[model samples]
Target: MGREELVRRVSEFAKESEETILNQVRKMGSSLDWSRYAYTLDEKRASAVSHAFVNMYEAGLIYRGHRIVNWDPKGQTTISDDEVVYEEENGKFYYFQYGPFVIGTARPETKFGDKYVVINPNDTRYKEYEHGQQIELEWINGPITATVIMDEASDPEIGSGVMTITPWHSVVDFELAEKHDLDKEQIIDKYGKLLPIAQEFEGMKITEAREKIVEKLNKKGLLVKVDEKYTHNVSKSERTGATVEPQIMEQWFVAVDKPFKIPHSEIKGVKSGDEVTLKQLMRTAVESRDIEMSQNGFRKTYFHWIDNLHDWCISRQIWFGHRIPVWYKGEDIYCGNDAPDGEGWEQDPDVLDTWFSSALWTFSTLGWPEKTKDMETFHPNAFMSPAYEILPLWVSRMILMSSFHLGQVPFKKVLIHGLVRDKSGRKFSKSLGNGIDPLDLVSEYGADAVRMGLLVGTAIGNDINFDESKVKGYKHFANKLWNITRFILENHHEGVPKTLPDKAIGYLDELKHIVAEITTEMEKYHLYLASEKLYHYIWHRVADQILEETKEVFASDEEDAKIAMSHTLNIILTTSLKLLHPFMPFVTETIWQELPQKDEDMLMIAKWPHTKD
Candidate 1:
């Protein structure tokens, strides 16, 4: 697709989604402005990315090198690890006979250019066969002796202790070739075509060449077997859904190893003594107990990841991102915020990775690089609530980036929520056809019930098995809240004001205690526990106990007693409404408007009920 069409579609889709979500938030009684907060990544974030890249490059961490990347042929660019997803595909595991050995492979099309074979020494089948042992392998062109070597990568548990080393194709083979002095014989071209080494089959596509190669092998009595029903995982481009070819390319990388501080330890790097590095900041934050992880178990995983973190690749061969600012003039490099001044110097065509842009989200969204008021006010953000999958890729990078740029961690706390699953326990996904649209639920049970249903039984770092019954139950709760409020308003025939009677005021201590409990739970990120507490107070305490007592007082028919009881009901209802407003804002606002609320009062913006001295 053209850039105009692609960008227009993406923008329109995002605009619609923003409208949907902002409408829901408004219906739930939130005060956030969608227009003020929304930002398109590439457009608004380019300057911030430029600043970060310039800083990183000057720090001596960024360098250009030839590396293997996840290449999308359709997109014709390099995609991030998060963008590529694996899909199970049905294909043949074609095995070709090389000498007395049967070499198993998923892509037999590349077999004509295969250099040599490797076998692990631990395999019992290959244990009898010593290293350097030659076998007479019948070739289509001629017969040749193929030697065997002990390769740790060749595991007998999965295969026959042998690996068909295709240096140009596999990432593992590429890495192995780099570490050793093994000569890399390039066979497959960049377009997945066999090189001149394929003899008459030169320049043939990998897919079509596979069939011809297999037929040729069968005629030469060298074909082994093919598992037609073999299922395997393959990476595909997220944007275009095209299969990715791991092609070798020169890219820029951030040296994340030595200078970066290792988590779960006190050893600072050599350059970290005087400098305010991300590692130093993170180490200090962890040591001082400044960072709060909602699920403590995830901290261990975070520590393990940071401890073993390798160099991060930050460049991509794509157009839809922030282009690198470096320029080259006869191999003399230039790094700056803008393109170079010379006529002969050409800018690098590759763009910065998406993660590099997202790393600046917290501050970049709030205006950075110019030291604006928004940046100062919201530089060190309070909370980050992303999914657990991007903890390493996004969350960790955000922390590192913020610490490096701003000299502080971006967020003080992280609330890692669970994924929502369907009733059968399958994750709600577009491909699975099991996704439950929130808009449909809002239309069916109302937005309040939908919000309550989501927040009711969820725990930190646990997936929620969504059921319609929970939503139905919350709908009943909404009904109960409406009915109870209407009951209180209905009983007050004397037009009771917002002011409370002395007897009603006596319940302030108990109400304060309840408010304190809820506030504490919310502060600790125990959302489910807070929801449960609200349910118990509203259902059991007010509806069952207090309402029953008020009915008894009304039966006695003392004018003063009646006033006290009515005022107490209103007091409890008002407090309860305020407490539940964050979760069930729509229902609470509807009921609050009917009561003796102040002029121009809004339930969502009203102060949270707090404990009194």
Candidate 2:
């Protein structure tokens, strides 16, 4: 399909998918305000994204440069480092003779791009090969001259204590080439085929070229040996499942290490006039404890990523994202919120990376770049809960963008959660045919039961091995709660009393203690602990003990004892419904509607019961 047709179709599909997702969220009882909902591609969000890009560009933090980036050959786009998935695979390590030196490499196909042979400066084995010594390498393609460079970064322990530099194909070699001002050659095309420099191997795929080149090298007596059991990590694109090729490309990037004056900042020890880099802004947000993580160990992971941060490639060769708000009129370039007045300018064909727009989600959803009530009230969100896998991809970028634009962290605290896997600890996937549809479970068991089952035993930042039995158990728990409520309502008096009678005072006190404990657990973000406590208290204490005792009291002929029993039952039923509303909203709300005494129109807005009350 053409680019325009593809974009139109994708946009329609996105809208339909979004509506389907929103309907599911409503069916699952989410409390989000539909009136304030916003999409990343909406006009307001697109404006906010363009405004952010222009501002950052003017601040010198965003630049267009040629640098090595993760290139997804299948997607035909440049992806960020976070989008690359590394997998360990068995491969062969080939040792090839290069004139006087023998070097080891896993990829013989990239040898055509080798520009330098680097050796450790302290390695006595290559001491005779002085720095800048010229030597002719008997390459499979033909004879090529390479300079011997001495550098301490080269490992003397690996391979033959020497390594060939393929600057355009490797990140380390690119950095080394920049450090030593060495030349770079491009031997791999964007389609992963050999370039014209490979001669007979030209136009061959990288895999095919590797086999053919090895055979040629062995025929030429240049192949030393090969290790068949060599295992190494290969980077693959997360989106297309294609091997990621590190290539030099001119793309728009966010300069993470470039210092820019803080336009505004709300973080402690950081002021508007202070100068800091994007890396520092993200690091300070977590390091200063302004944004606490759910799991303390993830803080170390966040710091390690920031310490080794690289310039972010924010451009993508895709048709379905926010088009970069940049125009070119021959040599003249213009970047702004809107297109320039001239008719001769053509806008950039590529779009900005998806994360570039998502980074502005917290504030942009509240009408950023335009002063508004929502921005003032909700810009600094209180909390954010996302999967731990995106700690660097989405979370860190949100912090960096918020700090730069709004001068504060996006949220005060982040609760890192984990993926839900099958019972055998395998991730849910279509190919595996093990994916569980929550809607199907909600259909079998009530929505409240499914919600309770998910939260009952799951801890923060821990993967859930979802068991259908847990949902079945919670389904039974819901039935028990409904039956208990029915019995209490059937036996209770018409009007709720102002205070409990003396005989019911003990039950009231015990209820107060349980409420206090559950409230404390919930405040600490211990949802699992709170759910477990509520499950036990309601099943064992209320239904088993209190109801049995109340039954005897109701059977008495004494009028005062009966009234006290009915009043205590009413209080316990109402209080428990309120406590359980968060976990089992649908069932609790249904029960709340049947009660005679209710303070709010909806149970969601009902005042929480206090221990003193």
- The segments of candidate 2 whose C-alpha lies over 4 angstroms from its true place after superposition are 494-503
The TM-score of candidate 1 is: 0.82
Best by lDDT: 2
lDDT per residue, candidate 2, 1-613, as tens digits? 8999999999899989998888779878898888998999999999999999999999998999999999999999999989999999999999989888898899999988686899999999877888999997678767888898999878988777889889999999999999998888888999999999888999999997887899999999999999999999999998899999999999999999998789777896688889899999898888888888748777788899899889999999888999999999999999999999968999999999999999999999998889999888886899999898899999999999999989989999998888889999998988899987778988999899889888988998899899999999999999999889888878876544566666589888999998999999999999999999999999988998889888877777866667667878888888998999999999999889998776787899999989988
RMSD (Å) of each candidate, 1 decimal: 4.7, 1.6
Query: Cα lDDT of model 2 overall?
Result: 0.89
Worst 10 residues of 1 by lDDT: 261-270
Query: Clash number for model 2?
Result: 2
What's the CA error at residue 241 for candidate 1, in Å?
3.6
Candidate 2 clashes between residue pairs 3 or more apart in a chain or in different chains: 265-407, 266-407
